[model samples]
Target chain A: MRPAAPMSIKPQADAVQLVLAALIAFALALPFATLKPNRIVPGQPLFLLDGPPFWARALVILALIALATVTWLGCRPSLRIVVTATALMAVILALGSTAGHLPPSNAYARLSPAAGFWLLTGALGLGIADGFARLKPSPLAGLMAVLAAVLILAGLFSSGWLSGISILREYQGRSDVFWREAVQHVWLAIGSLAAAIIIGIPFGLLCHRRPRLKAVALNGLNIVQTIPSIALFGILIGPMAWIGSHVPGASALGIAGIGAAPAFVALLLYSLLPMVANTLSGLAAVPRDLIEAARGMGMTDRQRLWKVEVPLALPVLLAAVRIVLVQNIGLATVAALIGGGGFGVFVFQGLGQNAADLILLGALPTVGLAFVAAVIMDALIAWSAPRKGRGSIA
Target chain B: MTFASRAIPRLIGLCLLLGLFLQPQLFEPVFRPLANTSAPSIYAQAELWSLALSHVVLALGATLGALILAVSAAVVVTRSWGASFLPLSRSIANIGQTFPPVAVLALAVPALGFGDRPTFVALLIYGLLPIFETTLTGLTTLPAPVMEAARGSGMTEWQCLRTVELPLALPLIVAGFRLSLVIGLSTAAIGSTVAARTLGEVIIAGLQSNNLAFIVQGGLAVAGLAVLAHDALTALEIWARRRTRLAV
Candidate 1:
């Protein structure tokens, strides 16, 4: 057998890349770390990190670095690496808890003010840089774009009245609170998105191949889309209740009246429309000649799909994922009503408590997450898509 | 069939009215008598109309607020350095959408509490993403050549945007608006939870009183509102597209 080529990751050369990756990974965790539930109310100030002891903060930072390093290193590793990392993390958290290092506040302090700021800035800067790099333009376009961007960034940064620093600090701290609530909310949203993609893509494929099924699926999804989230939740309640009562193992799984089960099912149903529509549109957009060419090349149906059609259609498919993602983010909020707990806890809690500030706490992060995800997903979709002029959907 | 299509929604509206008014036997069980004594369900009374109007006020205001924030943000992003922040903005928007509307209600309840303000706030946040995204998409898709041509003729960026981009993007923007409005309308039902009068009040009342008719009536009203908005928007879009096509 031929020997494999030498593997190389130049240490100093990789430092910049590693730092960039580390910064982003850390930023993603910032929001998670800051997410917690305590002294939360609207109007009255609720600190994201309400003045924890100094040592606690140090420990938190250490834990964050440890987590970040482990996660980063873990990515390139084999099975043994993962097993070791998991064991280490478990031990650290266990030991850390004994030494009072496990609490969120300690985690925050450990993520030193300087480090936190650096990581946050670096991640955002890199994200913007990456965005610009992808949108390569003519000199004129580049110059004009840069000038315009600088002006806007300056205004935003210097919008002294906006008090962005405090807002950002709070934002970081709230990320901790969000992290707690988002665990389930994120799961439900992702679960729904996955289910949508699975169900919708196949249905779209089936519809394309079968005329009768197409109408049924199309009309069914359309009707589903039209039903408001609350009403959809209401509709699912009855069926879910029946399932809980009659199904063999539903009760064991805690399929109660209002909770994750009904919420998950409802969100999955809600997600079907866009996923199906986008998949159908993407498949249809594939050129007829291409498929025929594949056939002429003596490729079987399966091979044609795997080789030609899907490659051409992937960008659109990813765009559908984007749509479902945005849709899921919005609809997942409603899951709060049925007790499928998530960031909605903050919103409902804020509302129930009559706290606008608290509402802002919940609402702002949600809006931020949605916008960021859409942009990132759009960028990914654009990158993955077959090179061409712009398509109908972004 | 075309005429029927046009007439059916109106006819449904009429039948719904008649079903409640003349056919007492049909709706009585569902719409319990308003007073314990023997009156018709309050949902069929003048009180319900007033309640619905109040709900409309809240919904419209919230939707308007959402529109202002979404459109302004979208325009700024597309027009200026806002582009740099687009990803972050999109992410924020996602979070907004993901943050549950009910939670907004609950969260708002504490600050605004038991009134229209909280409902308005919730609806506004809930309605933002579609309009924001659609507006952003519409603005960005302004044919670059058209903008260049206009710019070559010495039109300023603002002029180019106002004349070429805005006009072209209107249809898509309106589509987003329509979506937001429908969503806002349906979600406005949550307003009933805090005591603002709306069609939702009918449903909630029915729930409290165990009157199915009230629930049906409320639900139908909500559905009717959605269809009306959808049709109106569809018609507007057709007109706008035709006009744009003719212009081109």
Candidate 2:
């Protein structure tokens, strides 16, 4: 048999390249719908090659070809490919804007980008990110790219290029109510998180001190966690309603069954498992030697806990807080179902009216809030952790 | 560790399961007092067992789909050539979890035209990240020495992976499955909003009609399912851990 040619250690197309190529191919082959006249109506769709002005279509084709070339040629020009991908994404966004301007003024037609438009935009964004990742760009560089893209999109939005979009129109019609509901959503999430920390920490501490109670307490909490959020809300209503009616001045405090009271209570209960479980684990994790040293130094129980244990446990506790905060932000959306005024009001209303734009209006902000909460909590945990290590040395 | 002691937990679990299924018959007296004066009885409208079964089926379908996708992706990424795609996979999974299921349902309804398909899509997406992360963790953290020994034993790469790595990673992979299953159970209730047959329909009807009995029944059924599933999985995890300990 002829000896096989010595294996040339050539790098094949990596996952990112293959994925980007597939995405671009899918975008090219799919039909891009230019507009939908209303929220419920279906729109006319045409192939990307068939739609848009000649120059715009040419630019898109060129960008796709460049991406394909990079996929085949391998990693040598990844950075340039990323820049091209980012430009392509921006162009797609602009194209979305320009498409909105296609229908006549005073037509009351709502412009909606079709599946292909969304797919192409998403693919381009992912491709850009993948390219940047391959190049090992700084975090700040990624942030700057995102900010620049946002600014360009904002400019387009301000110039009314996307005026015909239904979601934006939904926002414009209910700006006041939107702001009110957003504020309420924040307030509900924050209130429950604060309550959970206050109650859960002490509860956790008690469980930690009494090993016998730990299993029962944790098991109870586990069961609580498993109860669906809606179920918890449902279970709370009767008790809340009874309290509002029977207790003197409770109604004045807004403790009704079908409103914020039940929502708040359910949210607090949901937050407790994470808060308490984390606190218990954090306390348990405090090194035995450190506590013994504190005791040998003649520190009292309260002093030892406050000065040493709390500080040592702070990182884990912060992690719990992070979990609770992010979870509560998501859970509070269900409060709207119970007449607790929040962004969920828009969600339910949209569902009731069969209006997808209104649903997007509510859902996007809720997701954004949850994302922001997660990021902030993560940052806090990272910041607090290193400081504790440094403080122990000092 | 004895049979009787182990049997105790199982017995209790069985009792809980029986009680949950028989809730309408068993709890009728309790619910009768709480029933709204104007509305029809909760159990009269729908069969609780059927709803519970359908809920499980939906969750199972989603969890199974998520498991296959996540495991495939995790396995591929753990391979040397696919390692660079780890961050990309992670971010994609993260986005799946970040988008609320309600929003998913809303957007999907337009394309999928409502019912089980949209709900399935939502659950599939929602369930992907946890399993994916766990599988990634399980595969990457396999004992390096064990893997090396397998390679040294004249095993091919695929055989080493199949025989050495996956067996060791089974417990963690099971943990991931458990988590995704529990999450799927809770999230599947929202499927009713999209006209999918789920326990959420009973709860929604309860809310709309202001019937406390209906709400209680639905809520109790869902809570029971979650608790039972959780306990069963916890048992499985413990068993897997023990088996692995013996094997090692």
Worst 10 residues of 1 chain B by lDDT: B33-42
Q: What is the C-alpha lDDT profile of model 2 across A260-374, one tens digit per residue?
A: 9999999899899999999988898888988999999999999999998888889899999987887788778788877887888887788778777787788878876776566
lDDT of 1 by residue, A49-130 (tens): 3333354445545544544454344333232223333332332222222223224453322211223333544454443443
lDDT string for model 2 (B166-221, tens) is 78777887888888888778777867777888888888888888888888878877
- Give residue A255's error in model 1 in angstroms: 4.8
Could you tell me the lDDT of residue B129 within candidate 2? 83
Worst 10 residues of 1 chain A by lDDT: A39-48
CA lDDT of every candidate = 0.62, 0.77
